[model samples]
Target: MKRTLVVGVDGSPESRAAADWAAREAVRRDLPLRVVHAWLWQPLAYPLAQNRDAEARLAEDILKETEGDLSHRYPGLTLTAEVLAELPVPALLRAAEDAEMLALGTRGHGALAGFLLGSYGQQVIAAAKCPVVSVRSAHGRPVALPEQGEVVVGQQGGVADSSEVLRFAFEAAAAADAPLRAVRAWNSPPVYGYSLGPMWSADQFGGLEPYEKAALEQALEPWRLKYPEVEVVEHVEQGGGGHVLLTAASDARLLVVGRRVRESSVGVRVGSVAHAVLHHSVCPVAVVPHP
Candidate 1:
């Protein structure tokens, strides 16, 4: 694994917290922390009317200002800061490609209270090229992954593909010493199976509960194959995906989910699953980008 760590620094209190957390992660993982700040400049209708040099300078200043506490707080972690003129997400995405893990703070957008992921953290988690760790500003002081807590994987069974997800999930499970619960949610009535037609008997759906449970076992196959030493607690239930994940996240340490992969494309899809978890999970979420 690439040992370099990357973090998004946006001059907000949350971003500052993220830097502190990221530094601690670097120290824990024995890696270097690369702090990145992105700034966007609006253009005029006619063309390059106003200058962006000033904006760039201000962005650089913010990066410097964000480093205030690192010398005293995180001296051992190697810190590198850069200012990009592009949008936050893409800039951070490029940074993540070379990083083993990307750490970020949860910043809220809507009027709702508490420390939820803001727009920037949501975007980064969705499309990051590597595992992106979304840290809560109000929790986990040192920013390390939980040593003894739940590691819940948002499993949707066959709907979500790839053993990579399970691999990442189990890796977290091993790291936390927390029992891993492979969660797969199923609800009544097909959400969009219009062409499949209706079922004949309620007993037909009776097998679904068992089938879902078996699917969880099947999903665990590759994970077990890779890491037989890691023990997992399988959770196959019927409910909404986001709700189930969040409910399972209660007092949990780390919630792991795969970045939604498109059918034909190489990049990730930043879909509702990611958005929902990023904006709502009480604990930090680890978004494992599809490889």
Candidate 2:
């Protein structure tokens, strides 16, 4: 399936880096690239209902110049450019309506990106209709190579949340010619709270681990048959679910996650954990719908 990728460029060094990245990515997937540069009419300056006469023109000129440069630089790649008269964040979000993925460059050059998602990138990711990627270097840096081989996607087991995360994970893995690591987390019951009536009986505890393991296998069975090409790495681990997912993400090019609060096409809200992972994951995070 050919995916449409939209990338934002404000002509900043980082944005240029994003352009390069987007070019390479589009080529890898045989997808088209749409480059967007946004301009807004400044609302007011102090007590005055402001003047955007000069600023708007300048912004448009910059976008046009940058678009021309990108066209020359990525000659073989399919490209499209647009200059928006709307705010960068909202404009990008609107553009994303038809895009499969939205890409951006991290705007800050300091040591604090951990706490700062650039104003434009932040707003777009918070409510974007599709997955968003914020690049670290947009200009002279080398574009990130597409996933080398089968990419690995994390899967939690048995729990409803895990089931939801798996569908997106497997679909993405297949798209990238990657593998799916169907992960199931397990842990011993708390030592102090073990004697809760009949629930903690020796017989129940004795068969618990084996039963849970079977359940996990059962959950992944259909997926295994459906996507025989996706190398399935079933990881049954003893640790926290989030932590296990993070560890598995180390070698993955992209991690696909799902939100619990599924929305209609218009009101999609990527759930909190998925949001948190996006901010913290070392690789790109793709938030998928699992409702």
Best by TM-score: 1
**Residue 169 C-alpha lDDT in model 1:** 78
Q: Write the per-residue lDDT of candidate 2 for residues 1-291, one digit (tens) a residue.
A: 566888877656667666766676676667789888776555654795545676656556656776677678767787878777676667888988788678877653322111113665656765776667666532444235445543444454354655655665666667667767666666667878566563444356466566556667777777777778888777777776567666777666766665444455666555555555655655655554443
Clashes of each: 1, 6
TM-score, prediction 2: 0.68
lDDT of model 2 at position 272: 54
Span of 10 residues, lowest total lDDT, candidate 2:
108-117
RMSD of each: 6.0, 5.9
Off by over 4 Å in 1: 1-3, 40-61, 65-68, 108-117, 136-148, 189-206, 263-269
Worst 10 residues of 1 by lDDT: 108-117
lDDT on C-alpha atoms for all candidate structures? 0.69, 0.63
Q: What is candidate 1's lDDT per residue for 212-264, written digit by digit as tens?
A: 77667877887787777677788877888888888887767778887755533
- Work out how many backbone clashes candidate 1 has: 1
Model 2 has an lDDT value of 0.63
- Candidate 2 residue pairs in clash (backbone atoms < 3 Å): 16-138, 17-138, 17-139, 18-138, 150-178, 151-178
